[model samples]
Every structure is written in C-alpha cells, then in structure tokens.
Target: MAISLSAARLAVKSPLIAQPDPSHTVWSRLEPLATSDDVSDSLQARIADPLWMLARQWQFNELQGEDAGSPISAALAVVGLPVSTLLHQQNAVDAVTLPAGAAAIEALVEHEQVLSVHPKLNAQAGQQLMRRLRAAGLPDAGQVLRAQFPAALPAPDDAVADNAGFVWHMLLDQRAIDAQALASTLKALPDRAALEAFTSGLGVAAAQVGSAADLLSHWLGWLDELALDGSAPGASPYWQPQRLEYSFALGAQGDGPPVRLQADEYADGRLDWHSFTLGAAANLPGGPSEAFDVPPKDAPPPRPPLPTTARYPGMPADRYWEFEDGRVNFGMLGAAKSDLTRLAVLEYALVFSNDWFTLPLTLPTNALYRVSQFDVRDNFGITLTIPPAGWNMFEMSLQPGAPVARLDNALYLCPALNTLEGPPLEHVLLVRDEMANLVWGIEKRVQGASGEAIDRKFESTRLSTNQTLRPSADAPANGALLQYTLQTPVAANWVPFLPVRKEGATPANWAIQLQRGVVTHYYQVTASRLADPVNLRYSAFIERLRSNRFVETTGVQGAVDNQLQGFMFHPRGSLLRLDPNAPVASDFLRVEEEEVPRDGIELKRRFNYARDAQGRALLWIGRSKTTGRGEGASGLKFDVVTRGKV
Candidate 1:
C-alpha cells in the first residue's frame, strides 16, 4: 500500500502538465529535446502524474479564452458563464483579505443599513410600541406589597400594614389592569395640563399601593381577569413569531370573563398592568435586554431607491470601454428627438484606448461584435461574439448563471439588436490626464511588446465634461442616457461618441431570439430576492443549512471562494426541459423575426421597457390555432403573459 500510494502521489501532478487535448502531438512533447533517451524519461514522468489520468478521462481541451490560470476565466469557462463576471467574481473573493479593521468598518456600515431600514422603527408603529413598554415599567413594587403583604405598604395605617403581614393570603373583589399598556398610554399622552376638560386619573391605580395585601390582592385579581394563553411563552396561538419576537401577554383578556394568577418562571412571563415592575419597564421595545437606542421619535429616516429603479445608462451597442458608475446604478439612455423609422437597427461603439483620444464606433453595416482590449491602468474589458448568429452564450444567469458576474464586475453587452449586418466602426481612442503621476506611469508601461504600442495623437479640441450628462427630453428620444465613470482617469484624450439614442437606434438587448414564434426549447431562469429576508439562509441562525440545499443558498461567501466553488461541485440546481414558445413584450422596441407554425406563430419582440406598478415588463405571448396570415387579411387576437421572475 505504501509503494502504491507513492506512485499515485507522483502521478497526481501529470494531468496538470499534460497536453489536455490528446490530438495535439506537438503539445504533448514531454521529453527533453537534447536526446531521445531524455525525451522518453520526460514522457514517463508525464504518465506518472495523477492529474494526467483526469486529463485523459475527461479529454480536457484548451480553447482560446482569457488565461486558463486566471481565476475568473477558469471559473467562467467551467460553468459556461460570462466573462463580464470576472472582475466582480474575483473581487468578491479578494475583498475578504482586507485588514480586520477595514472588515469591521464594513460591518458597521451594514449594521447602519439595517438600523435605518428596519420596518419597526417607523413613527406610526414605534410610538405605540414604546408606550406599551413604558407601561410595563411603571407600577411600584409597593403596590404588590400592599395588595399581598400590607406590612410593606405605605400610608397612615401603620397598624393595618403591620397586621396584614401575618395574613399573606388576601381576599378581594379585584378589577383588572394591563399595567404595561396602561402605564405606557399614560406616559405617552401630553401633560395632563394639555388634556381637555375630562380630568380624572384611575384612582384605583393610585390607591392600590396602600398595603402589601391590597397590592397582592389587586395583582392576583388582574391575573385572574387575564384569559389563558396556551401557546409557548412569547407566542400567539394564531400568529407565527417574527424573529426575536415576543408577546408579553396573549389570550390574557380574550374570553368571557376574569381569572387569577398562574405563574411559572420559565413560562413566557406576563407583567401586571398596574404592577410596579410592569409600569417601570414601559416605554421600551424588547423590554430591557433587547432594547435599542433609538433616535428621537419625530425624525424620519431617509432612503435610496433600489438600483433597478435608479436612472442608469444602458451599455453601448458594441465592445467599448466608456465609463460607467464605479458603484451600483441602473442605466439611463441619453435619447435624442428624431424620426428613425427609415433606419435599421444600428450598433454604435465607444472603445477606450490607453493612448488614443476617445473614438466612436461606426456602424459600417452590422453589429460590431468585437473583443477589443481596453486598459484600466491594470485591467481589461471585451465583448465575445458567437458565430453563425442566433446562439445563446450564457449557460446560467443567476448563480453560476450568465457570467456569474460578481456585484461590481465589468459588463460587455454584445450581439446587440439590429436589422442590418456588417463590421462596426472602431471607436476613436484618446489619452489625457488629471494628475501628472498617472500620465508618467502609462508612459513607462508603454514599452513596445507584441508589436502593440500605446501611441497617442493629440488635438487642440475643447471638450465639455458634461457633453453626455444631460440629453434633450422628448418621447421615445427621452431614452438617452447619462455617462458614468468606472475609474477616474487622471487625464486622457478620450474619444467622443454620440450618446443619444434615435428611433432606429440599435440597443444592447438583455435577451435575444431568432426566427419568431412558439417552439419546443430547454431553458433555465434565475430567481433571487431583491431584499434580505430576516429568516432562512441567514448566518445568525444555525437551522439554516439543514434546509433543502435544493432550495436556498446561505449568504454567499466572498466572490472569489464563490467562483472557486464552481457549479460542478455545487448542490444540484433546478433542471427543466420543455419546448415553449419564445416570449413577446408589450413595450415594442424591435421585432427580430416572425414565423407561423402548425400550432402557433412565434413572434420575436423587443419591448420599449414600460413596466407595471410592481416594476415588471409585460411580455405578450401570442398564440393562434391557424397558420400563415399573408398580406394582412385578418390578424390574430393578442395573448399576453408577462415575463419576469419573483
């Protein structure tokens, strides 16, 4: 066993260095070139490596792509995800390496977000809650003493108090009280001086403290009046508990009449409305241990809209490196007023060059599908094109889905929607700077290699930074967007591109289709929650992972480990293979193709992006029993099924 294990250990390294593709004899050359014998020895070493076994079993083949050694590219290729996800995927992993102090700062920010957004803090609800809490803290302990053991009670009757101590059991025709609720209500109200003419305090409440027997008697009487709550302490019989939720009193008053004390320390405890402890604990939520230090009651909290709703700029129709926001933001199109009915779908590019001034893409004929190399000091960006057209590139869209893009990764929108075809125009690249240090650094990295040189040609052109910030406002044309910055360049002779969208302007579409209408197909869509749910998958709880991994993913680890986790080792995802018709949208932007079939005619539609109240795009999926409507004799009725995931 020891000898066999030794051989296996050495074999493990072989596949890592193997010619993953068996057909490539040149790539498989393992022996030294100086002698045939040495060559044979190298080949033997290759055969001994364990990895070589896997390479052979899987027939690993290397294809043209981002470096195989790169974490992003390797992960993307494995799951058939998009390259745009690389930056984010990698960053998500790398961020965890931040110093502990920085991590703590991030945690603090997260806590602030929670505090600001938690729903319980609202004025409409918080005030009432606080009042109830205050009520629990109010009633003095002397009241219970007077009601149950009068010797401890205050008053002019010292003899009565002394006599009551001997007889701990008290008799009483007692009325009920919700000490916490009543005390809170009393404290919350404006000064008694502020109230209208109705002026009378609960005399019974003020009088109950006279003696211990009286206090105990009244407390017991109040307890008797409470209805039985058969639920687990803090639980309501009808309502499921919210996380960390508590109901101090339940079913304590919901039945036909009054009852008395049934106490257990472990049972969800209840406080007397007039109990000294209950009144004293009023005015706080979570009682004491869970109490939060809240801001003044009158102030309102501020909020930012979700990224999907914020005004964001859509991507250029070609491979380009125009700036987009450094942080999360939805896109805004800088639309211009013009009638483009006569024009076809056109893809415009805006490529960024390290040396060249800003250049715009010219739509020579078709979508300028490209793989342009743009620099971000020490970064890269590009768009991949699939051949023969009408093919899906993203194997997954959510987790392990399209690009498996990390939250802040770069994006490349390609296969843009267009009716015409041909290579796109190259964007005019530029180089300029703000601080002198960056300009000098770029100049230093400019050493000519691969015959690819960073050369600049400057002009005496005056450019306005706000050139694309605001566009003309009009119907349809209002779609023009604002340009965002990804990384602020010190200075650059940046290329200038037309940022406005015309009626016939082509767009980098989200989903694509070919040959319109209903057809059998296999597809996978992703579902994600827009907001964090306080339950399930949360790290704060342990019962989380025991759930069906088939349904939920615990809060994801940093992006690197996330990507490294790759889809292959992941718990199985939902799989569905059904032949369904391609969907149609109501916000008609472009029609790619249309076809009539035996069962129905499929329409490939691009909507203008009008959304419903819930922010959903309404897609119209039309169906027909008949086929072939030529020359518009009679059209078919519209069948609409909205397209969006919850």
Candidate 2:
C-alpha cells in the first residue's frame, strides 16, 4: 500500500536558506535563474553586458535548459517541483567597499558566473569568502554544505564548437561552460588525430577538475584571466597534426585503469593537436560487445496468471498483497507515463550473480534486491529491476516542448534524439551517474525477445532470536517481502546494533556462554521453514572473544603512553594500560610495566580457581555451575545443584 512517509516530505522553512536534499541538482538548475533575468531582472540588468547575455543564453539553450527566459521560476516553485521555497536570499555584500574583503562577496557572485572557467579560483575564493564571512559573522553558513555539488562547464581550449557543445552537454558535473569557444579552439587544429594527440599524455592537473561543473567553472575563470568572453563562441580554436592522439580504457581487471593519451606539438588557443580518449573503448574485437538476447521480448505466449492470492512484497511489507486495501497499484506507471512531458532513458538491473554464502541461491544478506529507476527527461531516469516475478512495468513518452524539468543534468548527452513514428530502434544503453547525456548507447539489431533477468533473491537475515519471518508465494508484487514475528529464538551469535568482535590471540581469562534454551535462531531464514539446509550457519558462537569496550574501558593495568588509561589490563608481553576508545593495535599503549603475566590457569582441575596466600591453588573442582534450560540444552543437569565439601 502507498503509505506517505511523513519523514520524506519537505516543509519549507525559508526561501533564502538552502533546503536539504538527496539530489543536489535543483540548486544548480535554479542558480542561473536565481540571480538572473526572470526571477531577478534587476540583478540581470545590474550585471548586464553583451558577453553575459550571450553566454547565459548560449548556456540556457545549449548546455542545459530551455528556460523560456530563466530557470528561476520553475526552480523555486514548491507545488510540483521538489523545491521548498521561491523567495530570494538577501544579498551578501549589502554594500561595497574597496578592500578585498569588501569585494569578496561580489567577487563570489561574479565567480559564480565564470567559476567554470577557473576552478582554482573556487578554492581561492572559498578561502577569501571564509575570511570575509568570519568578518561578517556568518561562520555557520561558511560550513561545508551537505547538499553542495559541482557545476557544469564547456570544454577546455579546443577548436570544435559543435564538439564543445557535445562535451558540455555530456558533462557529468553541473557548472558554467563556454563550449563554443573551447570547441572553436580545437577545430582550428588540423584534424582529429592531431587533436587527440595533444591531450594523450595530459591528465587533470592542479587547480583543474575533470567533472563537467569543474571544467566549466574553470573555463569561465580562464575567460576572466584571458580577457575573453564566449558570447562570440566558435568551433575548432586549436589545430594540430595527426600523430598525437589518445583513448580511454578500463584497466586489465576491468576496474579503474590509467588512461592512454598523447598531445601534438602545435600549441595555442587557436588550435592544438591533442589526442584523447572520447568514450569507453569496447574491448570487443570490432566494437562494444552486443548484449545477449532473451526470449520474452518477442510475442511469446504469456505464462498462466499467478493466483490472485499471490502477494507482491518489498523489504518488510507486501505491497501488492494489500491491493484490495488500495495500497499499491501497478497501474501507476502508465498513469505516470501519461502525465510526463518528456521521457529520458529508463534503466533496469537484475542481479544475476552475487556473493553471499558458501552455498548458492539461499539468499544473501549482503546483496541488494531492488532494481528500478525513473527520470523526468531531466529529473531522473526511471528504471526498475525487481524480483523475477515483477507485476508491472512503466513506460515513457518523448515529446516536443515537453515540460520536462530541463533535466540535462551532469550527463553526457550526445546527438540528442526525438521520438520516432516506428518501433523503437534496437539499442543497448550504458549510463553511469558520472556521464548523463553521454551514455554509451549501442544501436543494435533488435532481438525480438526479452526474458526475466533477476536470477537470485535477497535472503532474510535473523539478527535476533525474538524476530521471526516467512516467505510467501503470493506477496510483494514488485519486490520481495520479508515478514517477521516476535518471540523468534535467535542464534547465539546474533546481537543487534553491536559490531561483531573476534577474540585476540592472548585470550583474556573470561567466562564462557556454554548454553541457552533448546531452540535457537539461524543466520538465514529461520522464519522460512522450508528448504532449511545443513550448516546454515557456523556452530553456536563457540568462538574466542575479542577485546570488548567494557574491558578496554575498565582495564587499568594495560596503559602505556596515555592509551588504555582508563581501564584495568591483562598484559601478555608487557604491563600495558587499555584505552577503550582507541582501535586496538592501531596505536601503542600509554604505559607499560617491565614484568608481565607469564602463566595462565588450566581450568580442567579448577572449579573456583584463583591464587591463594602463597600464590598457589589450595583446592579445585572439575565441574562448572550449570542450571535450568541451558543445562538441558547442553545435556547437563537442570534445576538441581551438585555440591561437595572437602
């Protein structure tokens, strides 16, 4: 059922103050409009200049949005948009003076514009802003923001205007950019190979960023430094010979690998040969590996409908199972699709393989079970990868003048496309959070079939014996449901909230948790009675104990150099004090004694063992105190006690 979680909703507290968010895109989207034309024409008129107008318009139309005039109005509206406020914040400077501190605020405002050009300025200005902010008594605001993010940027000094647009458009960051100018610089270079060669050996250097926002921010700063404005944009400003070129590749193990690149001799803003990697180098012989086809995509006969009694579930609740109660309806996707103005790429991920246990397919606590995504063309891409038995799917529409949230986020959008009249083309799209618009989409030969991609399910984890759960055939429509009950017996090893600790080599003389009740909880679904297997978990916590905080805090003898100062200690190699909070073995002890305990007790002949007046045991017993349910569980006496006098 659709329950509105009160915790997720945002309540507007102020217009000027920033709101907390999981996604920081709203801030960057609204920034241009925040102090520009539509919302604050006064501010726009105040900073009005040919260069500013040209740059802003180019950015609006090319880099990110269709901001009828400005993105402000939409960014501040609270109704449908995620924004919590609309009114602007008070100006920083309020008044201006000659000192660098006085101009710092204004400088920040201008820096915001050209920040994409010079990233180093951001840190510099940040320092200046910190000083001025302290002077202004706004240290609280000076603290790093939780929702702060990168901005967009145009390409660096390159000479291919169209390519510049492509570069900025496909950015993974959101910062200011002047791609037209950078692209122009690259275009002026002789050819592509030369262009690639010039950038081959190059890597992001000091004061520069690789993300879109950093790129653009630094670009703007460079403009200020060079006394150039991109209102007059260009393509191919740099040119070079073909010998120097480069490409990017994932390393040998398919993880992050160093890039292979080169650069040309030609150097100048006009044109330079810079060889560079453009996109993922498909290790496949000719191109990217073609995605394997499945049978469900074609018009295959549908399987018998699952019984109406079947329940659909998510983590703890069965969403579809409560359909009669109007909790969740699969119809929401189609309804949402009808309402959306434009459609961005939708993604689906079905975890086919996972690492959970020595045994396979029982379900793993460490693995994720849900796979889904949705984008408002610009907002977020909609995708879903639920259990293999998912009940519904969401579709999207592409349109003209779509009122989509100008989502061109930190994506690498390339050769933007529009909806077509026929069946969608066969393509495999690879998108990453880092590269939005520039997805590695492989236009493929449409395979006429599709199939269930999810092979494994997330298994239930029993943290406590008091909790019980079960799996249902008719539950959790989209995801799986895990239901729990109270009073479930827990595993001896299970304990909630505490990090598991293992015993160290020199065992601390401690008591043993020999037994409990007859029944116990399991590491995996003790709640699900079926298919229980042998060795579902390790034997009853028969493990040596690690040093616990209690011992660390209370141990008084283990101290050395101020460590373990607060507690008592049982030293092995030396007389050491124990500090509970410090990670053990990470640092040395605060203080230590020259002589250490050299011998330990042999419990076999001892019942109440200890050193006597002469430091020797006078009497001893073999049996330990055992009573009640634990006694029966361990096959020992229950209720009664055994005593003997010497």
Candidate 3:
C-alpha cells in the first residue's frame, strides 16, 4: 500500500504552466490592503490600573485645598490595589492606546468610591476632570447637560455664582429650563422695574418695563415675529425669500359678497390678477332695435326749434318736438373765448437689440402652453419680420389651441380667463422674436399714476425659468413675448416632442425628428438593456512537449523521480465554444494578430452584429493570446513528440 501510494503521488504531476497573455494582467483581489491589530493587553489591565484613581484624587485634593494627603495615599484609599499591581498597570492609564482603554480609565475616575471615600469633593472638581478627559479625546459624562443648554452659555462648573445668568441665557436662547426654577424666578420679580434691576445686576440686558403679563406678551410677540421671519434659533436666515400661495374657490366666491380691496402703503402699486375661466364678452346686438328713429345715410337730421313751455313747480311732462329743417338746437347762456395751444411732439424710437445690448425677453412660450382655459376665439395673428438688414433665422408663433394676441412692441399676451371671475386672467406673452434671439426681461417704466404710454426696456440678457414678467405698460410691437427656455426631454421619461392633449399614466414612446446642417436626424431611445444571448469560444493547441525518465528505484530526498524512460508528451487542439443564442448578422472583420512583449502573440477580431431583427448594428470583440511555456529537456535520451498528453 505504501509503494502504490508513493507511485500514485509521483504520477500526479503539476499542471503545465502556460505563458500568460500580455494584453491583460490579473488584478489584486483587494483594491486596498487592510490593517488589523489585537487590543487584548489594554482591556485586560483596565481593572487594576490605579493611575486614573490617583489622578482623580489629586484633582479632588487640589480643588479641596492644600495640605491634602499625597496622591498615592488617596489612590490607595480609592482603588485599594497593591503597590506592585499599581506600578505594573499604571501604563494602561498613562498611555492609552485603545478606545476601550480610555473608557476603562473614565470608569475608574467616575466610580462610586469617590463619593464614599471623599464625600467633601464638590462636583465642580469632577467636572474639571471631565473637561480634561474630553480634551484627551476620552468619553465624557457632561455631554447631555451641555447639549441641552446653549453653546454660548459658560459651563456652570467653570463660572462662579452664575445660576441666574445661566437661567437668563437659557430663556433667551430658547433652551429648556426647570419649571420650578423658572416659576420662582418669575415670582420674585414683583414688577418690571425690579425685574429690569435684577437683570442689570446680573449683567444681562434689561427686561421691558411692564407687568409680568405685559412683558410676557411682548416677549411672545417678538418670538412670533422671529419665527415668522425665520430668525429664531437654528432657523434659516431672514434673507431667504418665503413663498406665499393663495387658492380661492372661484365658482363659490364669484357671486358672493364683494371683498374690500386693501393695499399696503409701501407696495409698488403694481398688481397682477389671473382668471382661469373665459373672460366676459361684449353684449353687442346683431340687428338694430326699433326703440329710436333711424336716419337715412349721408343725410343731416331735421332742425327743430326749442319749445318754450311754462311747467308747474312740482310736476314734469314729456312733449314731442316739431321738425322744420330736421334739426334740434340748444344754446348755453355763457360762452368764453377758447384758445388752441400747439405742443411739440416728442419723437422717441424704441430699438430692440438683435446683437447689441438687447432685452432679456425669452418668450414665456412655456407658460402659454400651460394655460388650461384660453379662449381659442381670441387667438390673433402675430408676424415678426426683421427689417431687410437683419437676419431672420426662423419664425416662432402661437399655434391653434393656444390663444395668443399681440398688443404692442413689447407685449404678447396669452390670457387664461375664468368666466366666474376669481383672479384676473393670466397673460403669458412671448416677449421676443425667436429668429432674432434677442431676450428681453420684463421692466415696468411707470410715470406716477397718470395713464401714459409704457416704455419698457430689456433688463437682462438671459431668461430665467419660472420668472414672473411684469410689464409696466402695454407692448407696442406686433411680436412681444415673454422669454422662455425649452429643456431636452429624457428618453422613456418624457415625450415632449409629441403634442400633449391629456396627461397619460406613463410616457408614450415618441421620436424626435430634427433637421440639422446636412442631415435630418431621427432619435428614439428607451432605458432598457438588450436581453439577447451571445456566443464566445476560445481554442488553443499544444505543439510539442519533452519528457525525461530515470530507472532508479530508491527515492532521493528532495529529488524528482522519473518513469517510462525518456519521452516527449504533447497534446494538440483544444476548443471552448459558447453559443449564446444571439442574433448573428455580419461576418467578422479586421481579424489580425500582433506580436506582444516577451514573445507573446495576441489575436483580435471585431464583428458587426444585431441583437434582434431591428437591424440595429452592435459591435463585438474577440481577443486571445498564444504562447509557449516550460524548458525543453537537456538529455539526448529525452525525445520530443506531439498530439498527446502524458
């Protein structure tokens, strides 16, 4: 059994080592090496470490007074450990190496023995020790109390006779206070004067002059304002603007009692109102009524003289007039000479820049489309034609289903009307010409309260999204617009290119067709991975191998034993095939081999294929390397052969 086992072990040769591929190198299993060390020593010595107790007693005695016993004597009474144990374990506290060791030292100092053995030590001494421990990066016990109070409050242990000061600090900083202490403090203040004197005596700001009730009310009002303006503790700064939103039930309030209009005195006097329903229409009659006499076209009315009649003091009667030349005449008793004054006409031109300093009006085209109830009948035609000298890249105009009207040079209006009359109709204007690319921001140029022609200028060069544009006066051009920007729609997320009528549950599959410089591009992409199967294969063949054999039966220590005389064993041809069920559409191209470093050869092949019947082309890569390994046998008895494994 022993000889057979030996022969079997000898026959089990190590697998032949193949030359590695130069095109790729194996990577380390760990991206970064980790470090580890045992912390047993510090943890084991924690119970007997007397340095912590000694330090605690030393600090306690210092706070107590001079002439206190030595630190060792206090430590002996506190820890009661033997001198050898103390000396041996002192290093654990003196040189803390682990977080657990620090924790153990803290436990030793804060142990219950301190109060029993040295009951006279004030908490202040222990607090100072705690501060020292905190500085040393050790766990502390005062964190909970400190966190509850304002960070600006001096630690109570450090300050002398600061109870009242700490109380005031807590109240001012919105920190919690003991209810009993607070009540007593308030009760002691008989009046605001006394309270103020007490506060001043404590070096704190004076309380307002009033009774407790009045003082409380003032403080509460101030707190409320502070909260509203976001100035309270930990609140966002007051400079950040707060958004106020108001929603009214239009149908419910339309016919209700009229609301009184109140305006702030400091307001800019500019107000905007929007309505969701269609606006009121003029009640013009289609045909003439017979309530009055009608005159022939181009004919003068008959002239009638005024009738002089004497009427009773308390009664009045209606009388018909007799027409002679078909004219009625009336005269006033007094007439003054009227003079006509000739005024100079101020000729001012409004110029919008196409390239020069232009207005920041990027038409609020987005808002126009967002209107839920725009009267389609109110749609008007707007044409923006650059003068012959300007470049007309393209034209942008409102389309059907989106009502837009051009009022003047700077205002294009899209009114979202609410027939029931809740808010004023929202007017979304495309304030600039798209072809000109001149952005114009809304500016209100008002001259007091008089109704006058508005002269607005572009305030900015770029349009900000969701910005409210308020024009001072009516626009004067045929193409006035509020600037807007269009964002790229994410594929499979939004179908912005398609005409949206009703919002759907999920985004519809849509394509965008864009005409660019020479080619028109069509794009449609979905966020899904291809699920087609693919095939891969790798093959190599051993060309030759050499073998050696020895006849010695006695095994030599640390020496290789050979058998079957001298022989060359080589296996040829090997293949690894993977048929991944993927759609193959094209033949492989650019198949070639390159000589790599260390006499290595790499084969690379690329092919175009389709994953499905959609005919979309995809590229695949095939790469492999071939090389020789191991040294040839040196003895002549060793022979070389091929095509078999030994």
TM-score of each: 0.14, 0.13, 0.14
All candidates in order of lDDT, best leading? 2, 1, 3
- How close to the true structure is residue 326 of candidate 1, measured as C-alpha lDDT? 36
TM-score of 3: 0.14
**Model 2, TM vs. native:** 0.13
Model 1 Cα lDDT, one tens digit per residue, 1-646: 3356355665556664543655534332222233321222322224546676656434322322434221111001100111111101112231222221121111111111111111111121223322332354424432332233221111111112123312211211111222332333434556434221111222223333233233333443442222121212211221111111112211111111111111111111112212111111112111211111121111111321111211224433222223554352212222222423311111122222212222232211101012223221112333233232222232111222222132112112221222221111111111112221111101111101111111211110111111111221332443324433332222112211111233443576433212111111111111121112422222212221123121123333344312211111111100010111111211111212121122222111111112222332222111111222222111111232333332
Query: What is the lDDT for 410 in model 1?
Result: 16
Residue-by-residue lDDT tens digits, candidate 2, 245-290: 1111111111122111112221111111111111222221111111
Worst-scoring 10-residue span by lDDT in model 2: 451-460
Expressed as tens digits, the lDDT of each residue in 474-537 for candidate 3 is: 4353342342323221111000111122223245734222110010111111111111111010
Off by over 4 Å in 2: 1-114, 117-249, 254-327, 330-646
What does the lDDT come to for candidate 1? Answer: 0.21
Say which prediction, candidate 1 or candidate 2, comes out ahead on TM-score.
1
